[model samples]
Target chain A: MAMSDLYREHILDHYENPRHHGTLADADFSHEESNPLCGDHVRIDVKLSEDKTRIADAAFSGEGCIISQAATSMLLESVMGWRIDDVEQLDPQHVLSLIGVPLTANRVKCALLGLKVLKTGIKLWKLQQMQHSA
Target chain B: MHTQREFFDVHAVRRDFPILQQRVNGKPLVFLDSAASSQKPLPVLEAMERVYREAYANVHRGVYALSEAATAAYDEARAKIARFIGAPAVENIVFTRNATEALNLLAYAYARAFLREGDEILLTELEHHANFVPWMVLARERNVTLKFIPLTPEGLLDLDAFERLLTERTRIVTFAHVSNVLGTITDPAPIIARAHAAGAIVIVDGSQSVPHMPVNVQAMDCDFLVFSGHKMLGPTGIGVLYGKRALLEAMPPFLTGGDMISYVGFDDVRWNDVPLKFEAGTPAFVEAIGLGAAVDYLSALGMDAVRAHEAQLTAYALERLSEVSGVRIYGPQDPQRRGGVIAFTVNRIHPHDLASLLDQHGIAIRAGHHCAQPLHQRLGVNATARASFYIYTEPSEIDALAEGIEHAKRALRIS
Candidate 1:
């Protein structure tokens, strides 16, 4: 019943001043998604390494609840130096734990919207690369 | 205003709703979401149970004792609802799944059949999706133009704009009796008269209004009125689509199957009477009986008093919520011009976050676009947190809501 359980200090800090929050012009992969229920929108633009295996830089641009905006900010920080394979393996549970809150059944979607956009963007990027190499 | 406080025993009324007597998240359950779906009273719950246990049978076909009793109960339920809305006759009431289905029926059967090409269907910017989408679909299919009566900056419908929109090409005029998000109680008298003068049929979406106030279709003089049962303390899966007897008679059947036709042949068919023709297949008999009980419950309490109670609560909520910093409320400032629904936003606190924090204290409120995306677009807010009230809601709950907003601000670390 603690209010702090859902809106912790770290979440609000990241939400107030998000890290790496803007669209990328030199982006290799980009995707935008919105939660149909609450209309919380998030877009993730990722730049890849020259070798095309790791995420060199990541940025996000959108407006939403603290769980979503802060989640995207924290997600960008975590995935910047990650391999594409590791980013692809990021699941909903990992995103929820990163949010550091006990989200209810309904608010889980708000917390994971950024991760969903990133995973989808990476998947689409991998598909395009497969077609090019073929 | 002080005399209105004695209208009802809110504590006694709260006891009648058994679902409200429970605890959630280690706190007493504070239900502020009555506009979504009201909790049922004991009489309403027992009414449906009595039907299933005692008079369980298919209506209209069997001549046995059980079937006869079931048929009588179902018929009486229809009559009670017909009386509840001040319909001219029972034949005017057509049962549907919910308000959405009833509106779909009107759009498909009435508008599609009567209106011709290049006609206009005038709607407002404050409509819920149920009232807005069906007409849009009908307009697209029938090659009719669609126009909107825009809203003022304060969220009232622009009556001047509405008059200008009511040209000879306007074939139908429809709007919500009370906006679900903004809670604006629009006066339909002028609009109804103007539409009728232009020879256009007027349909009123009373899903929000009928549950909170006394509505007289004859007084409103609209051609058709639509509302749902679940939002008004009845069970789900039952609603009423009330039209004038003549209009329903002229309209063709929207759905076709068993119980809707008098006789059938491979080459030709004979449809049943006005209301039954629109109602296809087996109806929700138990739910209808439950709705009848809901009408009885509301009638015993009196609709005027029910409305007064909500007005008092809304005024209190508006006053109390204003005390909380950064809480911006939508809709008219006058309590007389609105319902118990309040859609609001807190500065730097997303509705989802506020709603989540409130749930910890066992306060339930809706946080979303509320099925009115276009209205939200017009209001320029992605989402809002809505707290709606009914008879059981009290001024104490309003205090809790304000305190909850403060708690949310503290939790979010906002100064």
Candidate 2:
């Protein structure tokens, strides 16, 4: 893999001075994901519409190495205002590919840390929506 | 050091390790993950092969020729290991799957015996999870407090904090003889002295140190020292836990099973002696024999020479990897007290990314927390990439690793 591909300038910028890195007060969905092996952690808070159909806002909070923090920040920017279905729609490989380089199998989980929180939040949203409909 | 003996060629040593000859990204493999598990040597391989091909049978229970031969081989292996660590008898040696299991054995048998509510266990922040987790569980289960000796800024264990932490409540002291991540060699003698004065038993995690240097359990004065065969050019599924004879004789048998029983009756069955009491069911006889052969191989090369060769490679790699612009090494700058392990972060590249690009150049390294989460947390990074050396590792391999890291950084342009 090219070093350039792994360290996109945008990724490093986000890691150095992260964007939207705090709790969203109006958040309806928040999920904490941790990579136990590496100790990477992220608490992703999404401000969802009451109907659970849309993401109104997104923010992240946690401590980790540069890539992990960068990835979470990029995720917040990428997912805001996107439909809940978009997050639920992502495959593991697509999430990995977004990092721009292929990953070794063990490190693949590190790349998926943010995607896991997004999926967990989506699952919670769907469950709440089912309960509301019932 | 003896330099008169015929020097072993790097290519010849590479031939002994079949994995080194294999292709990676269309290049000959450059393995740097020996800290995880060293590649097996021919003698170690042949010893296991002979055990299986010539004499394969259950140990201790069987009375026939094959069983007796296998049992004798296994017992002989124990004797060699006891001598290897300067222990007085084979009774002090209990076999386990790996260093982790050996540590858990002590946790179940010894730690459970004395630890109770309000007591404290002293451990160093440099412990691998294998050493740290077992004691943590004991602390939580018995309501015992677990404390750590904080690390210096250079990543060595802080001797001052260690001295201050010793008190009447402390029952046990455990720490790594060598940090698997930091590559820092720790001197446990003073801590052992203090713990002994406080009436605390000490456990030394020798998983890394035993492979790189000579380990004399008697000289170290540790109650228990655990090491893995896989990290020493021997097979997996076999390891050694050297406990003091009196200590082993006193502790309860952890796992109760067939081989561990003295005899069985409808109402009562007594446990066997020290090593047998702890060894339950069929042991890894082949692996044990292989480990004995590994001891012989390392002995033939001499541990002092192995230590010297590894130290040279480490210093060279550290110097070259640091040459990369914006690269940061987390451990000590001095090579004198450190082992061959080197952990670092590149300009702005993730360790996983560095590992992948290194793979393209047939260079292999370990990435992530390396199973020492607390150390990583203390260092304020989630993960770091590591390169560790062994007897078979060469200066050329270190150069390849440096070139690969530089290429990886330049390709990504993280700076």
Instruction: Spell out the clash pairs found in candidate 2.
Output: A3-B411, A3-B412, A4-B411, A4-B412
Local distance difference test scores for all models: 0.91, 0.84
TM-score of 2: 0.90
lDDT of 2 by residue, B1-415 (tens): 1132223455666677776778787877888999999999888988999988999988887789999999999999999989888898889899999999999998899889867889888998878999989888887788889999999998888888888998899988999888999998987677788899999999999999999888888887999999999999989999989998898989998989889989889999999988899999999989999999999988887888788778777777778878778778988878878899999988667687678778878888988899998888799777899999987787778778888877876666554
What does the i-RMS of model 1 come to? Answer: 1.1
RMSD of each: 1.9, 3.5
Q: A1-134 in candidate 1: lDDT tens per residue?
A: 47776777788789988998998899998999999999999998999999989999989998888888998899888788789899889777887778876777878888889999998999999999899999
For model 2, the chain A TM-score is: 0.84
Model 1's alpha-carbon lDDT is: 0.91
| Candidate 2: segments with Cα more than 4 A from true spot | A1-23, A60-102, A124-134, B1-9
Error of 2 at B234 (Å): 1.3
For each candidate, what TM-score against the reference?
A: 0.96, 0.90
Candidate 1 Cα outliers beyond 4 Å, as residue runs: A81-89, A126-134, B1-4
